[model samples]
Target: MTNSAANDDGELSLRWSGRVSLTPRILAVNIFALALLAGGFFYLDSYRSRIVDSRVAQASSEARLIAEALRSVEPDRRDALMLRLAGDTGARLRLYDETGKLLADTRALGLRNMVLRDPDKQGRGQAAARFLDAMIDTVVGAARPPLYRERADGFAWPDVRTARSGNLIAATVWRAPDRTPVITAAAAVAGQGVVMTTANATDITQTVRVERFRLSVVLLIVSLVSILLSLFLARTIVRPLRRLARAAVRVRLGRAREVVVPRLPSRRDEIGMLARALSDMSLGLRARIDATEAFAADVTHEMKNPLASLRSAVESLSMVKDPDLQTRLLGIVRDDVHRLDRLITDISEASRLDAQLSRAKFEPVDVGTMIAGLLAQREARGVERGIRLRYDHREGERMTVMAEGARLERVFENLVDNAVSFSPDGGVISISATREQEMLRIRVEDEGPGVPEEAREQVFSRFQSLRPEAEEFGKHSGLGLAIARTIVEGHQGDISVESREDRVRGARFVVRLPLADRQ
Candidate 1:
């Protein structure tokens, strides 16, 4: 999946921007709707165009057929042919010569036995006499743009001249004066000149208006549905976000208050992950705040003990005059000073231990090799004390782990040094490491008094030292065990102590670290 600004790992400040939104107004104000509207208009116009074209084409074909029939008549009796043709066709028929001379006009009836033009349209459709004749003529000749001429009329339309040139021409005009569409078709005859016919179209404007209204209604309904769907989508997107936003606001305003973050665990989207992150951050911040406060209090309490001792030593020295007493009091002062120094040093290192571990890069290091090196250093000091630091493992064997080798060695040093202080003179400290299951367990066993069952865990606490009776006071900081525990836990390991299983009286400090798995 692609990462987004909305992802959980993104900064909370960016996620809380006022301008960011889950609104889907983009869909409601649609571009596709505009496209569909334009398409509908174009479709209607195209349909209108097709209707007009078909009417014109039909008119042209019928005109050509009439012209062919007219060619069967003699030129002088072409007037009779035109009249006969007019009786059969439902159109306004007219005949014109190549020179634009009117040959016959079917607008009126013939004279009493003489065939002629009738401008009054009184004798129309009179052949084979009946009451239906006048009705047929009136309906057929309803549109007469030619008869209502301005007398200076020019038939300059391309179809007229085109027909006169011996070719058939069909033309349609929309919205003629009589409120009807008109189609005109003209064709040239072989000997009887050109025949022209005109027809008023059946009412299609009303039909088109009805269809346009229905289409508009359909489009309106579709647009409304689209808007409602977009609204639902917007609600779906914004509901969870609204809850999260409210929780964040509460948490921000009331910094110390516990805010319950909205958790949508079913949703595997960015929003759900962000909710989880916020919850974790809240809990972590509270915990760190509490821990730092406790640490500070503990540090102050530890430092006060040495300061009180130093003050006592100085006061006692000023009151004493004997050299032996003076020297002893001075030693006390010196020891207290050294104790303060050790406390400060250990405290400084312990305080920064977390940050140091965070920043330090880990590399592959053999735990066995590290323990061997540490023992070698301690062995020299042990030799002077008539004690021995021995490795129980086989030579050259290794247990590898991913760690900052220096820090890991410091962990071993603390345990071994503690063992040294508590061991009797000439005591042997046995150190060995072995892989157990998926973990590496290292034990440092010393011939010293084993920790009591009651204080076993507390021995790892700050300033909880249980030193050997023979060791000099204030020579070592009590922070050693605490610091070692901190470092081991930072490496996701555990450190604990118990009586040595192989011996009845000795103490065994066991350090269990996770082993690095190889691919």
Candidate 2:
């Protein structure tokens, strides 16, 4: 089940690894939104229809006024009146008898106020206007009106026929040659003649074109601004992220030592925080790698000495036949084997200590009480080589720290054991716990040859021991101080060794831990 799940995850990762990134996706989202807004803007078909309806209504009103005047005026003066009204209204007026026969026409009588324009004779501007008109029609799905044409027989117009059939007024809208609206209206003339008015409504097209032009300009400007802002966002965000990603890739590809992660110290945002974190992580990983390499080399060198001694002792056992010599060789072999075993055990503990400490949960421990307990345990077991154990602290003072109890005890145990190894017979091993400001300071001092100032730092390093000459070989591994330091640091505390403060011939190991908050 796990293998199948892993395979599926690997496939998904390969599918979408590098196909699209942040910049293009951001631009696409912004442009898609703008396009939706543009769709709403360019839909002007309904507006044009409203304008055409208004023009037809206006034309019908003018026709009704002319019809009433023709009925009220003298028959001999009707042509002059029709021509004058046509000129005033900017439309052609035609009079027809009840039988659909044309009686009098405004244009025939000499008024030519309006004319239909030929699209072929117009300039490039008009052509572009027509192109835009067609585009708008297609986009908005406008239904085209029938084309307008003149007829000598007045009955050919539906509105004229309706007027002749006793209707008070009727109107129709048609498209002119240049795709502009042509509005016509007819009205009954005193129940005898029919009066028709026709206007080339070019102003409708110009008004729509003007409105479309303004909206187009607005859309263009908005689109430009949106694209520019998207690019700026990409630069501010994606560019830095890309640089960080590339640096991480370099680190992953074994170029960690050469790659310098950007900290972006100038930025005070989340990106800056992430950059600093990643940079610190990379530096810490590099330091860990170096420490591991040095540790491995030290372990190899330490193990070789014991193994070489064991092999020599084993070889000498076979070469000598005398019982006494053989007995000495067997003892040497045992000592070397014990040394090797002790070295391996300490090495394993040292290597796994960091991982264990990282996962440990800490609790408040009283430094004075814990040391007193340790001292009591030592007294129960009897001090080694008659060395004395002493613990001192303020009787009522609380010296508490947050730490893993067992690991913390191990640190003090190593310190006391180290002091015992160095102390002379019947010497004192003094342990003290005291509260110092925010820290719980514990010190273990021994009356022995003091550590040199130059060697104090090296003594805490793994496999770097300063054992007393009188101590038996293979009795102590040098990892005690190193392991104690590791546990101290893991608890957010520190441990160091120095000469005793009172000019005494002994080493003082001081451990400081931040005091836990008061409950």
Candidate 3:
């Protein structure tokens, strides 16, 4: 890549890196928020698990009670015992023989009695009995032991005989169950395979729903709180930076002597530390600029006297010498004297402004009135070299500003004189003023050879000139525009030159000054 492109890339990289480095503060806030959410999840998980375990324990107790009641019934009278138990417990009851054969059922007996008493009740009851039988069979076949226990618990099944479908079958004998094993009452019942029970999940589901709603509400509140806190944090972090940026821009435009960093939060954070450091740096920079300006002023002042004496001596020598040699020597001496004078003047003015030598006493001045007065004064000099001058006040009464009258007049005098000097005989110089938002813009346009494009940016640099043609012709010092710029900028304003080509086809200098605030 070209050097300029590479330099631009390097600058961009530095800016991006600087931005990335500032993200740690934002990241810290996010991490804190994440920690809060994680803690909430952990608390909810534990709470839900406890609720589930409590429900499971309650279901296990109920299952054990029913199993023990079944064990208390004798084999032959089990049908009547189950009927009484079902009425007391409000549950369906089924009894099976030792051989797993269908015997007598309480629901079936109810249907048979209904047939003897009422025919319609008998049909309805019988249908209901069949449905209940099928449901019990399905449930019993599906049941499995909730947990396994070792023989160390001291229980075993006894062998017995039974009959099923006209065939003999073996039956396992079981001992009486203990109440403690059944209802927090420990008891060993043999030959009774296994029993299972389940609790209603509706309450658990409701609890879960409530917990989720509460969690969502908590998270919403946390999110809202986090947003408000983040906004406050971002403002606190960025306000000082924005202030610094504005101050830097003002300094670059030569409108301020030093940047004043505002006080930050009392906490000793990185942002606070950076503000302090930047304040120190600005102070140091202002001091260095002052020192440089003082040195330049001293040098310029010291050189002026010697230069004036040398020029006087050269003029005195020229008057006594032979015509041909004297003319050539005189021209060389005069040119050298003019160059020295221009250099001294530019250096002096630049140093004075940099040092902020003094403030011009302010007064209410009408810009149009002042321009007219100056033009009349210049015309009285009787040096009209065929250049037509015109003054136009388009803004009328709006062009007035608060300024130092004499200083303001001197600024216009320099501009007008410079335009007159550059204009060819019969060329025109126009002065105009227009009102812009919060400012007054004054322009001086001359139809002469204009400044070169390449040299426009550096035209206000001290002693720098784009006047090669003038230098060859041995006429015109180049400090006029530079001095004008300094005076204009001193008023918290800007001055710039606009030109077309090397030859001064037309040159216009625009000055913008802030309008006086009335309220």
Candidate 4:
């Protein structure tokens, strides 16, 4: 409520209300990315299995083709032919006779194991592939499966048994004794023996492993970006809200230190609206508190005057000997008591104004009808001071507005009674209503001394009196105008004093209220 805080509020603010925390917001945003990463991990596991199965199929087909080549060659020269086949398939080829005895071995050539160990070692293109494999295993902890050794001790293996039955079986891919991927296949060569192929499936496994490693790197990068974004959100949105909350607490506690309310109008979000609402509410509370305190002080001061006069009269009555003087003194005591009663009554009404207005249920009121009805009652009572009450508006017309009808009637009655007291003898109090755009304009003009420009506003303050010279003091309570102003404003209208348009000696009070949409 200080001038300093008021001035602080008027300055332009570049800050907005969206100071949100990035932590929670970032987590919310990354939800989709996390789901995608989960799906990728699942896909990788399935893809690794598929790769092994595909390599097994390929190895089986290679074994069948090599078996056909052995059948055409002479049995004695088959070993030299087997050496040529081993170089192509990168597998150790073995020939087994019908009795399950090993007839010839492809490793006699010494080139088969070298080819299987590092098939792509001779090519520079695969060097990067090997390095990536090592890196993926290091970072992701992709443990190698145990190696497998094929039993060839004159016993029929699954592949050899199935192949001799002409089934051309391909075994599942497994790990070799050297930690390389392994698969087996067999095919029978007519009048020769069964050709068994043992293949290292390291290429397929490495391919899947490298791809999964790339995906993991991508996921790590995305997680890092999401965290940074969350931090940014926290700074932009949440920080300002916390500042507002602290400012509100200071204002509520009536801190002696001035707290500057934030004026972050730049934001288009709900935070901007909240800041503005809180600022307005705080200012309103401060004004109400100041007004209530001032009103209470004024009430105490006003009440003291009557109490002092009555006390003086009572003390004087006991000492007076003259009967006539004693009667006059008693009357003075009665008059003081009456004044106190009237003052207290008006004070009570003024205090109840806010709560009564808040609890009042509003309805559409015909301003023309309300004023017309009030004017009739005042005229029927007959102004003892020879003041004539007149109501003027368009014939057969009405102007309505949303208001608490009974309370609004009280507003005009107070204004009229005040005007009657202030008017000269044989004076006419003119009340008129007219529609102006979307507003209803009403005026009460009195044939009395027009208010001075400086004193007009002060007249509506509690305990402020500007009564006529002829009017008896006790009959008028200065609170009438103040109460009238409060009631008018509570109805969302303004009441102001002005010089009457057609006369120089009379004062005019104009009221403008928003017109109701329906009759």
Which one wins on lDDT? 2
The list of candidate 2 runs beyond 4 A from truth reads 1-19, 165-167, 363-368, 394-401, 436-438
Q: CA RMSD for every model?
A: 10.7, 3.7, 18.7, 7.4
State the displacement of the C-alpha of residue 51, model 2, in Å, after optimal TM-score superposition.
3.1
* CA lDDT, candidate 3, residue 83: 63
- Ranking, lDDT, top scorer first: 2, 4, 1, 3
* lDDT: the better of candidates 2 and 3: 2
Off by over 4 Å in 4: 1-38, 113-146, 150-157, 176-180, 254-257
How many collisions per candidate?
1, 0, 12, 18
lDDT of each: 0.73, 0.89, 0.57, 0.79
* Residue 445 lDDT, candidate 1, scale 0-100: 94
For all predicted structures, in order, the TM-scores are 0.69, 0.88, 0.41, 0.84
TM-score (C-alpha, index-matched) for candidate 3? 0.41
Better of 3 and 4 by lDDT: 4
- Candidate 2 on 21-121: residue-level lDDT in tens? 88988899899989987875456677888888888889989989989999999989988888889889999988899888999988888878778999999
Q: Using lDDT as the measure, name the better of candidate 1 and candidate 2.
A: 2
lDDT digits (tens) for residues 166-239 of candidate 3: 22222211111110011111212234422222122334434644665687678778777776777677777777
